[model samples]
Target: MPPETPPRIFAPDRRAAVRRRMLNLQQAPDAPRYLLDDMIEDVVERLAFLRHRPQRALLVGDIHGSLQAALEATGAQVTTVEPALGFQEEAPYPFSGFDLVASLGTLDTVNDLPGALIHCRQALEPGGLFIASFPAAGSLPVLRSVMLAADADRPAARIHPLVDVRAGAQLLQRTGFTDPVADARHLAVAFRSFGREIADLRAQGLTNVLADAGPPLGKAALERAIDAFSAASKDGRTVERFEILTLSGWRR
Candidate 1:
């Protein structure tokens, strides 16, 4: 057997963070997490526009279960890989069986993203479709700026490294997927306060998970970062831009 793959970037504890945050969202549906889910739904809607409805569908990383319900509404049987229940450690992966596989905000934090894409492709039948959307390169520049300003003297690794649009397409093709297409869409999430934005990030399970992250910001630094973020606001409100990159392909 090959040696265990060492994590390159994201911390192992991030898996636990993902589990906890997602569970809280399910238990309390008060936050506007659905707005973000719109990005994932857009990928599916693109497939639907092509009339690529599936008879058997799989949804990986469903944050609120709404995506699964929406897919089922089209009369497709759906299987959701809920993070809180664990990462399908015991489920059988029947190769070439699923007609469609869609994932939402899942790939960004994963350690073995390439292997994950391979698995996703393997699970698809001949000519089946796979679409995944995650935070890619050119995302969250404003947050990075704030993090740097917070610690201009000693910066801790606050953000995880992410893939960009072109690199994203290469991975799909490298995984032996066909006709790979990738694109980026911009979203400017408005926030009245930096703290509320942090809360929203927590609500969506998007937080610092770098394996080599130095340490959490000191109280003073944290306060300074918050101030910096707020100060960068336009017209008394902060607008954070996120480049939602979507990658799509079909099995050859």
Candidate 2:
């Protein structure tokens, strides 16, 4: 008898396609997630950087940007919940016994950001640090402007609705993370075309959070948006700027 042949394989899923398209809007990957992850790792190597050796740590939320930073702050021996690798689906225990708890950029995305912070507080030992970073209110002004100018009839996107330096600090304090501190860094991302900027934004998992993202762009709107973006360009490149805020506090 002849062996049976397998059926044809399909391409990617529609949901995946949507995700990919949506992710393309941001000019960069979640900055707090990526950058802080590196910071964690690098901070670990130097003894002076440690301030104190962290035997155990908890990295709250899922932001690849800050993974390395968390790692650096917390040594390899340190146990981390929602561990970096294969950690997406895993939400380990509260880790209330940990010496340190670093949130990176998780809180902002939560529906109840304050509640999440409270949970972080509960998950740490007394006086343990709880650090985080989130896209500031000042982020993505240029992109927002272009979109708004292009589609005057439609409502603007709710792209960046998180804390800036002031709001982050206040939230930390309000959430009972004592001695809260916050700072921001303005990073400008330049793109050759508006399409590229939108694509990069999506790749970075940062894009319009508008309740109604609105219907598919009409030809006129697309052309208008492109024109507006082109006008915003400098030195032959369109620019999208973001002000990322890093915030931290300690459990009292």
Candidate 3:
């Protein structure tokens, strides 16, 4: 079968923004990154259920380098793939004999989700495990609603494209993975204001990357969005739910 062509719906400017933010994150080192750290913790927690530790592992889009340390703590020789390393379409896919592979917060933004998943499975030896997580399907419902309200009768595309967990599982199975499993973990966060929520998104590389994203909200629209967001607040704090989905499978 021919490879599925990924849509060119994300822009280069978005990639540049992510690079700048990631660089800032590396410097802060000890700064608070709740969402990112949670994903890393979740991945580590899942590893506890495995009978044997992985001998060789791969970490894609290493977040704050915490995951690398965690993987190394288990004595697994781990290799990291950073986005700034620029492993674009033209580059050779590296799936070489890894016993375990994990990715965090990167698959959703990829140009070719299916191709990437396929390569991840191929890189692993038989019985090798793959665990990956991304902000999929039900992420940021409040923010999405606010953005749409900001545009009122003429909503513009302001959110990044998110993968549905069902489709992700299908891709894993289609790519010849065995025992594919996918599940969503919900994170409920309370923020004092919408601006704070936006800041969290920036820190997590969860901004609008859509090539079709329209212009920034004007002053009036911004006010409307703020009001709409505030209306959903409870006890002077807005509640937001972030649905992060974890995908797991084993190389057949």
Candidate 4:
């Protein structure tokens, strides 16, 4: 029997559009970059701590260009594939033979995440390192509650589903990676209004890319959501939490 097809939960075109929007926004002086910066810092630290120096590196979905710069600074030749340039994570990579593969903030929306992970593993040379960081489960509790309140009797799918650390570890193991490791970290940001929080999500390409996302909320629902968000705030600001999951493994 043929292999089963992965469910089409995310829209590839929507993913590309959001990523392109993010790339455009990142060129502005006041773009929100905390999430990407935090992920990049963690990846760099992991590389340093592991003492694994890559002579050639492949970077996936690095919107800010900081990861490429850092890898180049380490004397590693970096090749970047960006969503803005029509790079699809679920598709087969055109090149291989890299000692390091670092994917940032893009894996969560792929429909065939396991296939994508397998592709990354296949692209690596023997003993190559693969590291990926993305928003994990348990993120955005405040926003989730507000969205639910907005929908009232009918809760809409406003947020994309996320993978947890345990699932990430299992994926690495299933994809033929050795010494797989998975961990999570939380980052909290205070938002004075719901609009500001939405803006941050848009700037980071963290907005909903689900294929079946519900229509825009009506004005009354929007107002209710805003009010609910405000009601949950403390000190005139609502604190939203993001759980970032990082997965690392070595190609045996």
Highest TM-score, which number?
Answer: 4
- Ranked by lDDT, the better of candidates 1 and 3 is 3
Q: Rank the candidates by TM-score, best first.
A: 4, 3, 1, 2
Computed on alpha carbons, the lDDT of every model, listed in order, comes to 0.78, 0.58, 0.80, 0.93
Residue-by-residue lDDT tens digits, candidate 2, 1-252: 973442222112322343344333333544223334333443343324447556667664433334535455445344444322233211334446666666544344444456566777777778677666556777777777777777777855445465767777787888787777788777677788988877665554455433434566678888888998889888998767767677767776
lDDT of 1 by residue, 133-178 (tens): 8777877787889889988888878877888888998888888889
The clash count for each model shown is 1, 35, 1, 0
Clashing pairs in 4: none
Q: Best by lDDT, which number?
A: 4
Tens-digit lDDT track of model 4 for 5-120: 99999998888899888888888999999999999999999999999999999999787679999989979999999866878677778999999999999899999999999999
Question: Where in model 2 is the C-alpha error above 4 Å?
Answer: 1-50, 61-74, 78-93, 210-212
Model 3 / residue 134 / CA error / Å: 0.5
Which consecutive 10 residues in model 1 have the weakest lDDT in total? 87-96
Model 3 lowest lDDT segment of ten: 86-95
Off by over 4 Å in 1: 1-7, 88-96
lDDT of 3 at 205: 76
Whole-model alpha-carbon lDDT for candidate 4:
0.93
Order of candidate numbers by lDDT, starting with the best: 4, 3, 1, 2
- lDDT for each residue of candidate 3 in 168-215, tens digit (9 for 90 to 100): 778788877899998888889998998988877877777888777788
